[model samples]
Target: MVGSIKSGKSTLTNALFGGDYLKRGAGVVTSIITRIQPGHGLRARLEFKTWDEINADINQALILFSSTPPEDGGGDFDINDEKDRLRLQHDLSRLNTDQLVSDDTLDPNCVLLTEYLSGYDRVKGLVSSEPVTHMFESDDFHKQKDFVGDESLAVYLRDVCLTLEAPRGFGENLEVADCQGSDSTNPLHLVTIQDYLIQTHLIIYVVSSRTGVRRADIRFLNLIKKMGLTKNILFVINCDFSEHETLADLKGLVGRVEKEVGMIFPAPCVFTFSALYNLFKSIDYKGGVEQAIARKDRRRLEQWREENDMVAFSDQQTEKFLKAVIQKVSMDRFALLLVSNLERISSISSGLRDWIRINQDLLKKDAGEVQEAFSKMGKRQEASDQITMVIKDTLDGTTLKLRRNLGNDVERFFDSKSGEIVQDLTRFIRSYNLSIKDYEKDLDASGFLPTLYRIFQTMQQTANLFIAESINPKLVNFVRQEEKKAGDVFEQVAGPYSLMIKDAVKQYQRTMKKLGIKIQDRPFKAVRSPDVDSVKSDARLNIPRLAGTIQYSTRIKTEAILRLSIYKTVKTVKKLLKKPVKEGPDSAMRSLEASVRGIKKQMQESIKDHFLDYKESLKYQYVFKLVDAMSIELYEALTDRMRAFTGNLSDMKGRIENEGLAKDRLAEELASMQTSLNVALKETRALEKLVMIDE
Candidate 1:
């Protein structure tokens, strides 16, 4: 089966199975459906349906037969009018198949008749103005009419009739159908053709290079796409060398046609050839020309010369051209071979099945390993408790240091320096908080884990300073004294605070290392080895180097012990006070009370400053402990699970490699078997050819 007019459908059919089963003429010569099926001997059968039968079928399908004109109007309805009505009915009925009813009797009153009758009048009125009937009945209908409703019916009838026959020999079982080329505009033609293409296992789409791809070709391609018949269409480019001199030119023209139509059909196989050359080659030119020339040569000398001229004219040098044509014809044949090979490959489904089976097992094993790792990780909750305890102990140790060094004396010292120290510490904490805020902002900007770690570390240090400064008044005073000396209290506080932070960080690092997770550290160098090349071979000795001589002169003077003189001046002044200084116990007590109140105020300020300083540090320590415990457990679980995963992956890889090798061997064996079968077929064919030659 093929598509469109001038699509080379007939030429490809003749080439593949041999014999011209199709009518080849200018334009759509095939007006009726031509079926080429196997016969008893090497012969062809052309079946034709009379015009009445075709008309009857068309009328029946459209249900136009039911409508009869008034008696006075006569039974002679305009064929053009009837056809237009039938076409319209067909279109309406095509929209909905449910309206159709099956009927055994081919009568006007049948259910099928009623359905077609209903839409006939409307359809007829729509196309009444067009000359559709004249165009359909004309000889040029197949060539230029662009549509053939009758031709489509003919093709359908052929397919249904052929299917009733029993199986025959290899060549006899095959069927070649020559369809009308100008059936592009006919909806019925497309419908029937589309049905045939879907049903048929193989199809050859014929195309003429001379006309190239026409509007009809696009119409046919649209039908094909509508039918989704891309997989079945085989492109056959009928290149007539009589029209085109060079094969390259023909190929180029054909290539363009193929590309245009190929966008729609995209047939797996494409062939280009001259169909006229093929028909000419099939004639017995050698014997036919020789007989005619011999009879003419028996006449006068002039006649003999004319006979020679005739013989010379008949010598068309067709063998070379025939060979090229045969090569082109073989393309469709090769397409069948490729189709057969693909079918053979499709038979082996075990490899993919086996892969699925293996993948399922791998998935199950991975799931099990994941479960086991999770179970192991659940048991590591105790480590988190241990980490918490360690953090608490570290905090307690720092608290003890604060208590031992400062204790009750902190209140008195804070009374004197609380105002200055609190301002400095507050500024220092603010700067630290700002730095932490900036680091967090950077982390948010970068979204990198290293930046996150740096932010965490900076927060941790600031938190440590806050904790230490809040508790110890002596440390705060010491920091203040250092600040007073440096003229910058924040820097002074920050310096000692930075040292304390470093110590705490070192402890945290040590804790993490003890848990078997080593943090990154500064690089250190080992003691340098002696440079042997720098050693000398010789030594020098001199008495001057030992300090042998020195010239000296000394003057000695005897002096008696001399006495030292001392002078002193004393001045006394007496003053009378207006108010007397009362030396009483109550005054001393009042003064003490004022001093105690001041100390209490200073202690309260110190407590406030320390609390503010340590707030962030304490929060960080809590979070750090929580995160550290979780991280340790997560790392341990991940490491163990990854090791198991790697082992399983290695095993799976080995198994897959072995299985793939086996499958490859199986594929190779199948290919070798197919090759051997092909070789045997070729040998048998060659032997048959030899036997025919001998006969």
Candidate 2:
């Protein structure tokens, strides 16, 4: 069921079920898709989407708002900046995103919404279904509804699915669903409704009879037809508690709606039903049939009558209202319609039995001819061919997935490593005394060698972390995870073999049950422990060096005066305090800057080559070794299943050939099926008679 907020969708759904299975509060309410079914006991289980899903939804909402260019073009919101991000957070909170916006959650969008279920009521409770249904109006369910923006009603709806069960007479095979109103500004809700539309057997569209049909109604009705649910829809012009009026007004409202959406919902399918009177009346009707109306319900009914101006409604007027419901909706029409559909399914099942019998005969003759040809050619080659195909698809798919994940690990290591490298380089460069004229006072003259060595050591550790530690853990976990997928591959290869063997065997033994031919169910021996220990190891080798200092005597920055130079020819260090009259200070710092840049560039290139070769070496050491062993184990498993299936095939054919095929069992089963179909067909007619069909 789809409609605008406060259009009485939940109330109409309850009326269809002929009782209150849904919690309906005053005014427009939150958006929730409630699925109703018949149950052995009254209970509700609600599963909100996971944290990742909620985060994705939040991102989508933020992205929508962010993508739009500011009118003045000042800029968009910077979500990464902490204080700036509060605007979006506050907006979400104001829309009633309570738990989803809490300070307790480090990242609100990424926190899991709590999940719960009202404990199942195995015993029908004493006047508590009202309270039980109200449980849905709390926590993960309620706050999420407030995001869409009707404050008195639903602000927004996201990620809540509810299922309810009414008593037997209202809902047996019948299921009714309600979604957020059609007038919702959010297109996301439309996508959700469109998907669920295909799953439902019927659509109940509740529009307030006061308005007839509006633009939102038109668009949603068109969406319904587009989803191919046109044939199974009823356009309900719900006049829940409108002032009493003439038949002309009801027909007039129906006429206007028919003109607007009649192309999809024909006149026959257009209904005018009471949501308010019907709901209260159902409770009133259930009072005597049930033990008695509880005091709570009686008081509630009095309030509703007062609110809806039904206080003056006498017994005669109430009777007229009910008779009108019987004439228009008949309450049980939807349930009866569901029963008719079930009867149709039974008829289809009978037809399938005939098709199965005829196909069995055709398959046997075709199989015998194929088997004769196959025996002449030999079965071993064919079995090998089939196994090869399975190996390529399953085994190759598993390996490809592993390769992608491993590549992602490699890329992530490189990305983070680059950031660390920049940080270290910046720290190293900025620490130099660019303006110092005396190396003794500012350039760590006493421990110059130690300082240089410490810089080199930091560079090396950073490189090693990127190339070795990062890749090792990722490779180990990837190997373990992929190995399980390969075990699944061996199991996957077992299925098609049995199915092929069964399809072939079904030919000779049309009545296989009588012949006592049972296909053996055997599991493929799962892939044994594959050696992946070799896959886990550091791949880095031959660490790169930037050992030697400047070739010329110079400072390291544009304005620097301090300098310490390691002489390339003499292997001695000299600190330059003052430049000669002919040599300019700017010339020294420029020359020094060039040399420093060259050293950094060379170190980067060396580290890149070191990891590239290490990655290459891993293929021979890990990837190839692991794949070869896994393949051998999986191939053996596939061949074993093939042999077992062939053996079973021969045994079944031999039994059917030696013992006679039984035809009497087939006749008895067919007779039993036909009887069930006939019974269904009879009741469907009786149900059709119970509900007044306006059409």
Number of the predicted model whose lDDT against the real structure is largest: 2
| Residue 357 Cα positional deviation in candidate 1, in Å, after optimal superposition | 33
lDDT of 1 by residue, 79-160 (tens): 3456655644554444222122212212212232333344343333323332222211122213221212322222212221
Candidate 2 local Cα displacement, residue 250, angstroms = 2.8
- RMSD versus native structure for model 2: 21.1
Over the stretch 200-256, how does candidate 2's per-residue lDDT look in tens digits?
545667778777677778767765554445655666777634443555555666677
Looking at candidate 2, what is the lDDT of residue 650? 40
Cα deviation at 230, candidate 2, in Å, is 1.5
Cα TM-score per model: 0.29, 0.38
Best candidate according to TM-score: 2
Cα lDDT over the full model 2: 0.43
Model 2 CA deviation exceeding 4 Å by range: 25-31, 64-163, 166-174, 263-267, 288-695
